[model samples]
Target: MSFRSAVMAEKEESTVEMEETNTNSRAEDEELADGKEDGLEQEEVECANLEEGGGDGDEDEDDDDDDEDQIDNESKKKTDQDKGKKCVPGIVYLGHIPPRLRPKNLRIMLGAYGEIGRIFLQPEDHSVTRKKRKAGNNGKNFIEGWVEFRDKRVAKRVAASLHNTPMTNRKRSQFISDLWSLKYLHRFQWCHLSERLAYEQTVYHQRMRTEISQAKRETNFYLASVEKSQTLDRLRKKKQKKGEAVQDKSWDFTQRRTEDEMRLEKMKKKGLSKKNLQKAQEKSKAIQEKAQSNVSLLAKIFSSGRSKD
Candidate 1:
């Protein structure tokens, strides 16, 4: 009976050990499944973040495109404004305006035809101011002026009909002769005039500078000047000889035939048809004779009447 009881106890111990091992394995499997599920959820969250970032990047690109478009539009508008400012149409230039004519009076005369926009009168020359002042002149003689019209059509009409027409101003109710000398400036702009004036001034200054430099040049020695003068004389003689040779070659009057001479020769060779001309002359002579006879008869009748009176 004792042996049977010990074997039963061993079997019971083995069964309990197997049950603990099985429970530990089940707990480990459950933990591993929970970790896998957490990893999957993290991956899904990362994918969602990547999608949202991609959308933001696309939105940024669209905003950049819109900014570029706005910039382009603004640049175009600026270019248009610049073009409009540079090319001003319907502007006319009136030159040689009478200095006595004030801007107000000029507008009054021109305004009869059209609306005036701007007027520019040439300024009095400062270099001549002193001379003019000494001559008892207030520098109000005649000034060159320009007039701008508002409408191009009105400017054209006025320029056509009013060019070279005389202008007159009243003085104490006496009728003064008008000397209207108006000219239409074609394709002439104020800027062009300013440019020309600037160029002329530059040229004048350069000429003055050159003249001063030339005057300041060292004088040549007497012997050297004599030699130079002799050389110049020789050159002049050579030029004269060359000119004479050229003249001799160009105009050999002995052989040259003028158009009139050539035509006379041609007519002599061709024998002109003078029959029609002779007929015309005879008819004219007959008419003259008839007129003279009529006049003489009228004169005789007048004489007879005078004698009777």
Candidate 2:
């Protein structure tokens, strides 16, 4: 073969090798770039996943806070209701207790035993009333009040535990051992407003006003007429000691009023005659007994008639 042909062959082979190397280098560069791009893509995906996971955790935390707040509110309301002790159905209506039994220390002592609803220290309004009442026996003071509990069982336990206790602090402390088991109250009822007794109070006031007015007028007239009348003549002469001889004819002017006269005047002013009061009381009692007997007889007749029918 010619030398030129050989040289051309060698140059062509070298050119071919250079071209292949260039192509292989380009392929390697593309593969490396692809690998880097794949790594970057993976990192970005991981970042996105991390952000999503963190957001989910934050949402869960928020939900947990809401649940906790709701529970707290519910518990607070329930606790308040129990503490307030709002009386409703199934509450007790214990009868009026006497004021002297535990006037000052009943509540203080009873409260320590259990959660009492209220210690109503007023009289019950269970009687018929009028518009205006007189201050008399009909004026009831609800000296008794009831205690309420959240649970009926608790109420029973408290009630059963409060009776016959030493309810005083003056050398006497009431022991509440017996009052913890009281039960059987359907519901509690309290009296709020009662009408005043009209008729009895009217009569009492009218009579008093008339007597006072008449007495005042009579008193003024009596006081004024003393100077005009010969009061000296009517006045009883007082004797100087029985054994002494009287020499002076001049009478003592300082004889304002005898003890007897003053006592008579006081009696009249006060309208105080025991005989008169006794007679009046007897008449009233007689009338009451007669009316009661008549009522009893009528009731018997009605009952008999109804039974026959």
Tell me the tens digit of each residue's lDDT in model 2 across 1-309. 699999999999999999999999999999999999999999999999988799888889999999999999999999998888854423454453542344345556555655555443444444433322543444433444455545565665555665444334355434322232234365443232112335546876998899999999999998878754555433423334344444545776765897546755666688978786566567767887898788878989999999999
Clashes per model (N, Cα, C within 3 A)? 3, 26
Q: For model 1, how does the per-residue alpha-carbon lDDT over 1-309 read when each residue is reduced to its tens digit?
A: 999999999999999999999999999999999999999999999999988799888889999999999999999999999887662435555666655667777788888888888876776666677788888887554467778876666777787787766654566522144455556676766678679879979998998899887766634455678898899778778989778532332655567787555655665677766675456557767887888788878989999999999
Q: Which ten residues in a row have the lowest lDDT in candidate 2?
A: 188-197
Q: State model 2's lDDT.
A: 0.62
Say which candidate scores most in lDDT: 1
lDDT of each: 0.74, 0.62
Tell how far residue 45 is off in model 1, in angstroms.
58
Output the number of the TM-score-best candidate: 1
* Off by more than 4 A, model 1: 1-88, 91-95, 123-130, 168-176, 216-309
